[model samples]
Target: MAKDDSDIYAALLQAIERGEFQPGSRLIETELAERFKVSRTPVREVLNRMESQGIASRDGKGGLIVAELSQDQLGELYDIREVLEGFAARLAARHAAPAEIELLKEMIASGKLVEGEARELAIANKQFHQQLHNCTHNQYLQQMLSSVQRSLALLSGTTLAEPARVVVSEKEHRMLVEAIENRDEDKAEQVARNHVKNAYKTRLKIELGW
Candidate 1:
């Protein structure tokens, strides 16, 4: 099947996420046009969309580059998300129906049996999170959180990529699921908050060797 501009957009975002196009790596229009087998018009449109989301930036050298997030920028992004997503979890705990809570626990358990392409693993992680948002049952919160996370696309590695880190992440996910299932709103929020906070620190270590 012939692909379209949206496909190119997704391909570019995936490339950025995979570290295939690292922070500050130049995105040559001609190269992208050829790679996506599309005209430069669509490539430019995708680049503009990325820039609006802060995923790419004008390099001032007549080309665009994947946005380079400083340590401070990274901290800010995750900190905002931690607060926002933590509240979302708390709401989900209080308002989610019994079936929704059960489904969450099931997904948490699903993490136990995982092996695949790194991209597939990452995608599962994304689905797990999207499920959490659905549990929240707030359209606005879910929409905003989704937008914020899209900006996070420039990040290369998930904490899940660290050796044995998926084990720890899975454990934390279980805790959050239990907290939600039990309708312990505070505990759910705290656990969800801490989970994201720790992931941010792990990302720092991975990115900065700190």
Candidate 2:
């Protein structure tokens, strides 16, 4: 793909993630083109790419709308994520270098310092998880985790938005990183799974008012 096309695609994805377009909202090519200051051709190309990823789909009126996940679908997604992330943590424990472990610790420390800034903390949290995935040194696992991360963008708002949740999340990150640093694969895997489970619980509370 050309650079412009890639940029437009990334921009559209970010817009969706930020809830600017909203779930199930129609995405008109002309409107998107005007919003992004791009031409219709690039917008069309971006929309096609999004459709292939199941991020957007054709509505009853034959126009594309943001894809919304059902409750069952969201639960399934979290279940898969729990398994994959736990495996990644196990692999990372065995494979991560000393420097990688140190980096993960630093990321957690930085996140703690940004307690009041939900947006910044959310980005930090994402970077920390992505870093852990890379530490696993398995390209296929990394790709799968990346797809799961994209699906999470469909959910509005960040779990880190809650101050209490942020503190608990930071503690979970610390425990997972410590397990990886000690090369305790079992502990790392268990901590990682619990981390994701807690996140799913928080997501349910926020999205479903459960």
| Candidate with the greatest lDDT versus the true structure | 2
lDDT of 2 by residue, 125-161 (tens): 8889999999999999999998998888888888888
User: Over the stretch 1-210, how does candidate 1's per-residue lDDT look in tens digits?
Assistant: 117778898888877878799899998889999888888898988988888888888877767888998878888899899999899989989988988888777776665325565567778878888888999999999988987788788787776677566666777888888888888999999999998888887888888865
* Pairs clashing within candidate 1: none
Show the lowest summed lDDT stretch of 10 residues, model 2.
110-119
- Listed per model in order, the count of residue pairs whose N, CA or C atoms clash below 3 Å is 0, 0
* Each model's lDDT: 0.83, 0.88
Task: Score every model by TM-score.
Answer: 0.89, 0.95
Model 1 lDDT at residue 159: 69
